[model samples]
Target: MKRLALILTLLSAPAVAQDAGLAARDAAEALEAASILLDTAEDSRDRVAALTDTVRAFEDGLAAMRDGLRDAAIRETELTRKLAAQDAEVAQLLGALSALGSRAEPQTLLHPQGPLGTARSGMLVAAVTPGLAAKAAALRSDLEEVTALRELQQSAAKTLEDGLAGVQRARTDLSQAIADRTDLPKRFTEDPIRTQILISATETLNGFASGLSQITENEVAEVMPPIEDRKGILQLPVRGVIIRQAGQADAAGVTRPGIVMATRPSALVTTPTAATIRYNGPLLDYGLVSILEPQGDLLFVLAGLDAVFGEIGDVLPAGSPVGLMGGDGGDIVSLTSEGGGAGRSETLYIEVREGGTPVDPLTWFTTE
Candidate 1:
């Protein structure tokens, strides 16, 4: 019965070992699947977690591998220390041998040929010879360990380099996404707040662009003369209805060589180009008047008129009619310079402009 029991126990041992091996294999397969899932994860936080788990698995997978490396380091330190100690002993032995050879009284230290002499010499040599042999063997082993450690460190460095490259790629993608978000604009890129400034700058540049290539400030002199009697032009100074016309000296107290005009009370006034109307309040003795700079050298007419026409600031061609002489035409009237400083009285109410400066009006007008 005892023999039978032993046989049964022996048969069960192999079966138990096989079951344990199968269980360990299953665990390893599961871990490998987990690693694959971790590698394929998309989320950054999840990826980091997976990488951590992978590192943990690697550490656990070959825990003995790490132990072996640590053991190698410890052994290396131990071997190095032993080698140093051996070298010291060898050095001491060499010194003693040297002293023996160089001694002047060598005869006193000499050992006669005998077993006792050989024994003493052997004792001194024994101090370093075996230790040196042991150190050489250990150094060879240490070189192998060093090579292995270098390989391991290289692998770690490569892994870190690859991981850093992946991180940099991710950062670049994110930055590009952000840049694309900010670059949306239909025309030239402009934020709402900056539109006004952009428009203003564009308008200012447009105004300058026309004259930029050819026009100069000095060219103003050609369009406007400085002297009250010199040749140039001036612009009309206001906008209003024509009330008094030029011509007809036979009408009731209203006879000026040039036109006398008036504007409604609500007319808007603005300076045209560069001009200065040379007049105080009630001018020409014609009633509230001012002269305009001339258009160009042009003919002047007289005596055939009926109504007061032409408003202030009215841009006129060379022979534009001022107006007919007198017909009702309320208290509204303005007289402009016609020829010289003479207009019924010797009062000169002329406009002037030149070179960004104002010139005289009567200079350019010719009498008709």
Candidate 2:
């Protein structure tokens, strides 16, 4: 009986993969949402924001589809390897079962030891047969699962391609919508000549930041709600991974009082809280930048963008798109690369200042 029980090892392995189909279903739902949004895009009050949501949905759907396919491939390979590894044990079980099953009960009952031996043999065969049936059923289940996973991978390829195309279209529409937006209220107008003079005279970021108000045409301050109360609980301006914290030295051994983040190419940048745009334009070596004031003397400076949205002095709502990270919209390249890793290829630098002094941004924003 013990020897026969060992035969079950040829089929014994708990399901190693979860329902990969669930991920594919989630992807389908997200893609559907994107499609609906695109169809009704022109009716949207804030087309820029609406299109941003659509693009994000497509991105999520593509990621989910890719993950589902990857998981299915992995599971199928594991099952195949397991089956190959236990081939010898499977043959052993089959041979042993054939001998036991080929015998007739009546012939066995006519044993040399008479009725007692015959009855014992009969009992042994009956006891082993049911257990064998259960194991055979489990083995069949695993084989079926492998087949299903293989078929899923094939179908998901089309879904993934559609998601990619949809997201690209949304991105293009979002760019156009942003270009047409002109309804935001302005706190104050900017003076280009004064800003140029300030930039030319300043030797460092601190000097330039300290004199930000000099470029403004209006001295009258707009009274906004208190943001100090929301300190230490603000969201990040962009979705990314923090590569460097405040005061961290880089490869050049130069330290900066800011947070450096790595993000996917062309990722949307947004405001963590409702704030007025203090400045928005190219400055110094920073590609393009936007300076925001969320409170009385607090400034949030975001640098290294491919494009900047909204004019200087425009008051933006929380989560408003400020700009896009520099990239040509290849978000899935890293996902399919040799490393099989995720993407975070663009760099964004964020600096927070209070009362003309630099502070740790992590203290004000929560990160994953």
Candidate 3:
């Protein structure tokens, strides 16, 4: 009976060893299954089931697989914490992406307060599962792409707005400039200086046209009556007022011009048929003035003599010296010449232009 008991104990020892090994294997399998559950679980209910199953297996083989059970528990704890944190972060990321899509919000890379894409979701997955880290990187690239596209769209919108504003400003300024120019002509007409310039231009233009026809000394000589013969007729030399008759005054208010000779009341001034006379007359209030009646136009005879020599109706014999200066000065002359004379004298106011268009006398008399 003692020998039979010993053999039975040796056989039971092999069975006991086999049972312990099987328990260790089952514990390892439970740990692996729990890890997979943590990696893929989307909710707390699933995670709880995996955790319960793993813990039950660990307890069942506690005595035979203590070390393995401890290791599995540690792994499960770490994976659980990581997964929980990852889920929370993923939820936040999803919320952020949703907020970015709202239309009423202003534009921004993060929607003013949140992310613009689901790429952040991969970050959570990576925290819990190292094997998925590469996928997380790919998701990050997607986030960057969407962000860049949004920024480009916003930039384009701003550029178009700015361009329209610039165009409007330019149009307004151009209109103002046109208005300013239109008012310039009226201003020029009101200004004294500008009026004077107009007067000068008018004279220049008239003179250019007048140069085409000129009278000659021969014409004047032919028209003049014979001086030596008493039967010769006397014609009006110039048709105009005696603007200033021959006159003068002494230290006690004496006499001058007419004192020397007789002048007609109104005469028709004429020129010789073929003569060129450039004569400087007297120094009157109207400075040293002159008269030139060429031999081309018989009716054209320049006769504002600030200085006069020949008497009224006197035959000058064509190119002969008519007279000496009788400058309009002092009292009487000032009434007529005003600023036209040298210092202010009543001088001849000659205006004999075609078409009745009055011109500046100075231009026609001198080369300048």
Candidate 4:
């Protein structure tokens, strides 16, 4: 009976730990890949894109590490509780084994029921001894795993620190590369006088959008490939979750003719399709904004950015980084947060205008 209890003590661990172990290994591999990316970023022909990739790699790795750590914490807590609960039974098993070994010779072994009982007791002990050894081996493995998990958590702190630093460096490099970039095609140079006059005259977004063509430096009418066929399938300019639909009011009871998306701080904001930059600066109530014209008479308005990329007249290809969301993005405490990026999110406001009329952005981009 004691032997059975001993085996039970070592056998109740859930299969959850195996998943955590796999996650930890995968996180380590991802971190290694990010490190390699950082090392090779400087040599890439397109430093902006390379650095962006590096930063994304680091973010993915850190997120995985956070998940693994959370799982390890939960598993360790369960193990501690289980082992503590079985302490009394384990002690009883040890006591019984001790009594069986106290007698040096088999002939000297005695039972209250005389020789027959003694023989039966010896036979039972012999039958169960190998099973006890196997259970003891399993208990040792569990204890070792617990120790390893603790060590992994401690070591991950440094990895988290390095990942944070590496990603920041990559982001900085990307920003600099964008600033120094000058190879993009120009649809039309922006005239400052026209832009300021238009802003001063317009009272609303619709009015401002209507006057976009008037700000052109030289109105030769540059023709570009049409994206009318790409409607309802365009990717979002940034990776985010839609928080508010078009015309939805906020806590302040103010509503706008645009959709709001919540995204992680410092996340890269890209153009969903090939577009010409009609404007890229602060406008009226909107913070920093990027106005893109994907086709004639159609405009995409992106607002609330910390940094803007590309010049006013530059025509950008698809997936080009337009700017970055606002935030420090270096929250060390969130390194072990289960879902990762526990920091507050920055919001991006997006609006689609067709022939100067505001329409639901979901008409072009799906939330999924």
The sequence of per-residue lDDT tens digits that candidate 1 reaches over residues 7-29 is: 23323333322232232233333
Please, what are the lDDT tens digits per residue for candidate 3 over residues 144-216? 4333333322332232233223323322332333233221111001233433344344443244224322211
lDDT of each: 0.33, 0.76, 0.32, 0.76
Candidate 2 deviant stretches above 4 angstroms: 1-18, 60-70, 90-135, 200-203, 249-254, 329-341
Q: Global lDDT for candidate 4?
A: 0.76
Which portions of model 3 miss their true places by more than 4 Å?
Answer: 1-293, 298-320, 324-346, 352-363
- TM-score, cand. 1 vs. native: 0.22
Error of 1 at 276 (Å): 59
TM-score of each: 0.22, 0.78, 0.16, 0.78
* Angstrom error at residue 271, model 3: 9.6
lDDT per residue (tens digit) for residues 21-124 in model 4? 45555766687788889899889998877877787787777666666666777777777787788788678767766766644476655678998999997788
Model 1: which ten-residue window has the lowest total lDDT?
A: 325-334
TM-score of 3: 0.16
CA lDDT for candidate 1: 0.33
Report the Cα lDDT for residue 128, model 4. Answer: 80
